[model samples]
Structure formats: C-alpha cells, structure tokens
Target: MFFSCKPAEMANLMEDEVFMAFTTYAAIVILKMMLMAPLTAYYRITRGSYANEEDVSRKSAEEKKKLLKAHPDVERARRCHQNDLENVIPFMLIGLLYALTGPELSAALLHFRLFAGCRIFHTISYITVLPQPSRGLSWILGMLVTFSMAYRVLSTVLLL
Candidate 1:
C-alpha cells in the first residue's frame, strides 16, 4: 500500500470534500498574507518611510535621510507580514499533509476555517492597533489550529 492508499484511492482522495475545503481556506489565507506586502508599502508611502535606497532614489540626500527613518505603522504592517510568513507557510505544508490523512470533512473545515479567520483577525488587529489581547489571542488561536492539524496528521500517519 502506498501511504495506505492505492493509486485509485488516492485519485478519489484528491476529489474529497475535506481536501477541497482545505484548498479553499488555504488559498484565502495565502492571499491574505500576500496582500500584506502592499499594505506595508502603503504605510511606507503615506508615512514617508522608505526602507531601501531604491525606494527613495529620486529624492535629494536630505529627503532620502528623512524618508529612511522608521515609522511605527510601517513596522506594524511588516511585522504582521513577517508573522504570516512564520505561521502561514507551516500551515500550508502541514495542511496539505493533513488533508491527505483522510480526516472527516467537518473536522477539516473547522481546522481550515479557524486558521483563516484567525489570520485575518490577526492582520486587522495589528493594522488597526487594537488592544493587547486581540492580536495576541488571534495569534494563539491560529497557532493552536495549525498545531491541532499537525497532531492529527501525525497520529493518522503513525497508524500506518
């Protein structure tokens, strides 16, 4: 048996509802993460803070020096993006493996939806400077969802 599923079985698994839900939520979170780059740029442009020489190439030396200073808004957007990189990439990889583990559709949807929702909430809280527990809670909850999926994947695979 190949991963305990024959080729025909694997083909059917590809069409599984649980796997489809995983892909949809995975795409949502991935797109949300990608948008952070533009959000960071928006903050940088509006706040007159440029991180690189190329970003301020047209400006005079004095202007360049002024633009080079860090802005809290830009930093917040960047940190959110960075956090996405740390969290979402693992979710994608582990999610793919988890989907292949033949989990129930409802259980997989709960995992996928919670993760996507938490990430979106995290971005919103970070950008709007929402109070402490909001951002922290979103991060913790999202991480928990990913970890839960990972545990499921491990348990399922180990059984084989």
Candidate 2:
C-alpha cells in the first residue's frame, strides 16, 4: 500500500497582525515619499539651497533658514515632511508591537488608519497654509493614536 502525502500549510503574512501594521507602515512611508515629490519640484523651481547640491543633509540651520526665507512653500513642505519623519516612526514601531500582542483587527485598523489619515491631512493643511487649530488638531489626533497603542502594549507588559 502507498502512503498518502500532504503538503504543509503556508501561513499568509497578510493575515498576521504584525503584517497589518507593517503594511500600514509601508503606506505611511510611501505617503511621506509622495509628499516629497512636490517639495522637490518647489525646490528645483525656486532654486533652494540643496536642490542642485549632491549632499543635501550637510546644511546648517542657518542655511536652512535662508532657504526658508527665500521660498515659503518649500519651507512648508520641509516642515510637513520633517514632522512626519518624527511622528510616523514611533507610531509604526509601537503599532507593530501592539498588533503582535493580538489586538483586534478593528482596533489595529483604527490605530493605523487614523494615524495615517491624520498625517495626510496634517501635511495637506501645512502645505496649503491652513490656520493653526485645524493643523494642530491633526497633529494631536495622530499623537493620541500612537499614545493609545503605547498604553495598550505597556499595560499588557505590566500585567505580565
């Protein structure tokens, strides 16, 4: 008699909670990259300090201020993207840990979507030169999302 053989089951990362967070991370990263496109165009058209330069990261704060003074739109884009870099990273990291802890899909989606959505709106508001409270609200909302996830993870660890 011949023995029957079965193939091992392949786990789909898409179904993993951490992968959900990772996909969200990718979206945020890509969103930030797309935000830079217009910034680059503005820089090139306005001839900002680092536009033609090979090394864009060596500029001192003074040089940056000069560019800002010369091109207000570029400054807006710069600040918008810089703020994203500061905020998005922590959100992604904490979110990954939070998801791995087996947070509900709805909860994870809430955290991921709200933060990314707020970030998009935040950048849009900045680039359009919107008033303070609206832009401020977006930043606050994103912070709250990240903080909530952090609390969830921390609370879980503390209980353990």
Model number with the top TM-score = 1
What TM-score should be assigned to candidate 1? 0.92
Q: Which digits, one per residue and each the tens of the lDDT, describe model 2 over residues 13-129?
A: 456765566586657656775767677576645666443343444667676555443466766777777787888888877876776566777788878888888888888798888
lDDT of each: 0.92, 0.72
Candidate 1: residue 72 lDDT (0-100): 97
Candidate 2 Cα deviation (angstroms), residue 41: 4.2
Q: Model 2 misses residue 135 by how many Å?
A: 0.8
Residue pair clashes in candidate 1: none
Q: Write the per-residue lDDT of candidate 1 for residues 25-73, one digit (tens) a residue.
A: 9999999999999999999989999999999999999999999989999
TM-score of 2: 0.71
